[model samples]
Target: MNVAASIADFETLPRLQRARGAGRIAVGQIAGRTRLRTLFQEGCAKIRLPRPTGPAVEAVLINTSGGLTGGDVVEWQAEAQAGSRLSITTQACERIYRSSGGAAELTTRLRVAASAHIDWLPQETILFGQSRLERSLDIELEGDATLTALEAVLIGREAMGEAARDACLSDNWRIRRDGRLIHAEATRLTGADIERDASSLLAGCNAFATLVSIAPDAEARLEKLRPFLATLPHAGASAMGERLVLRFLAPTGIALRRSLQPAIAALSGAGSVPRLWTI
Candidate 1:
């Protein structure tokens, strides 16, 4: 075998390239105003701080790689100091493309100090046929800290008449208050789970979302949310102690947002949805 010829042939062969990114941000109160204290970004992960219209500092996350596929990894971290307010949202929907072999992974970690509030309102995540994604969210809160979080998933593009005939998703969430676990949930769904017609499952719906709020007044918002939830086709809200959760299902993303926008506005401590959600 000729050495130069063999080397050239090896370089011609196809190779798989994966995406990786990580970002971190911290905010604190500075002389009665919330301000950014620390910011970090690496790889394709980016953080942008827009001017605040109110007391809360807004941070927008961007994935410069455009989309994710098999073997991709991304991580995010956020911190809010005592008496500070922070709100975070994504620049747009996250797209998950079909994987050739391995599954993509996404992880998020958050910390809220005493008397602080953090709102995590990322946009919907859309998955295509044969796509595989694993996601985990972990949060820690101190005394009287508040958190509002939303996660939505779309099976496929409704406008293109697409369906996630073959896909896989594994999601996990854990929230703790003052070192005590307050909420924990795990969700796993395969193509077969999406095909089931059972009501307890997706029920043939292509879109779904879960919203959660943990605050001192969480239960107080239940009654105010019920009237609005009743107007939507498939929306429900329940409160237990200081935790409130809402679930929504719709045939399309538009219908799902119709209910989600209002519900978020009510539960969000700022009394309005994140500006990015409208834009």
Candidate 2:
């Protein structure tokens, strides 16, 4: 069957998408407004950002594909205007299903205007056996804009006694401010080879998370947050210029999330947390 038909059939097949296989793409966006306070848009659907106090505007996208085909693509984007605050989070862990012979790709883009703030917080991505998934994220910021974002991945479901015995995963991230590149990172992992290089790749941990923040005085803030990071069990941080990067290697997703909260609080200064995270 064709891809679209396959997806429809899989959705109706009940156990197929969840048990054996499937591919899906979801997109969402939230913006700050004068009268409404905030606004949200998803794929063609729109909703007014609910009022009351909350962390910046936030959105989440999930891919339910049991695996990817030769031409599968997923895309997401977000933008925050001057003086506006927004935070985005994923509803659940992303699942990259087993692949037969093709590869899957996910691309994300974000833009933050001057004096605006944003938190791009997404849940972990879980890769099943024989899964081949490539993911990329790009962030563009106006001078003086601030951003804090996190990306986490788990190689196989350790809780389910699964290990990345035969999986290919590639991830890339880039951040730019005022058209100047500030940070770039990339990683690729596959099969037992990745596990053999565990010491250098992920310190032998099945779960890992990276948090990055960009601001005018990000270096100073990173230093201030360093002391707080030392309080976490398995977290470390580094800073360069207006960019700060933090990494956590843990045995489970809950541990990784716990390590991330305080770090984000220290860097963002907004006591508010993303609501999607609580769910």
lDDT of each: 0.91, 0.68
Q: Which candidate tops lDDT?
A: 1
Top candidate by TM-score: 1
TM-score to native of every candidate shown:
0.95, 0.77
Clash totals, every prediction: 0, 10
Runs off by more than 4 Å, candidate 2:
1-52, 62-71, 194-197
Candidate 2 lDDT over residue span 1-279, tens digit each: 499998888788744222222112222234434222333343322223334355444344444443343346566666676666666666567777777557677777877878777777777788788888888989999978888888888778877888776777789999988998889998777676646345666666777888888877878877787777778767877887777888888877677777777776676635545555666
To one decimal, what is the Cα RMSD in angstroms of model 1 from the true structure? 2.2
Candidate 1 per-residue lDDT over residues 93-201, each given as its tens digit:
9999999999999999999999999999999999998999999999999999999999999988998999886878999999999889999998877888535456877
Collision count of model 2: 10
Question: Which clashing pairs does model 1 show?
Answer: none
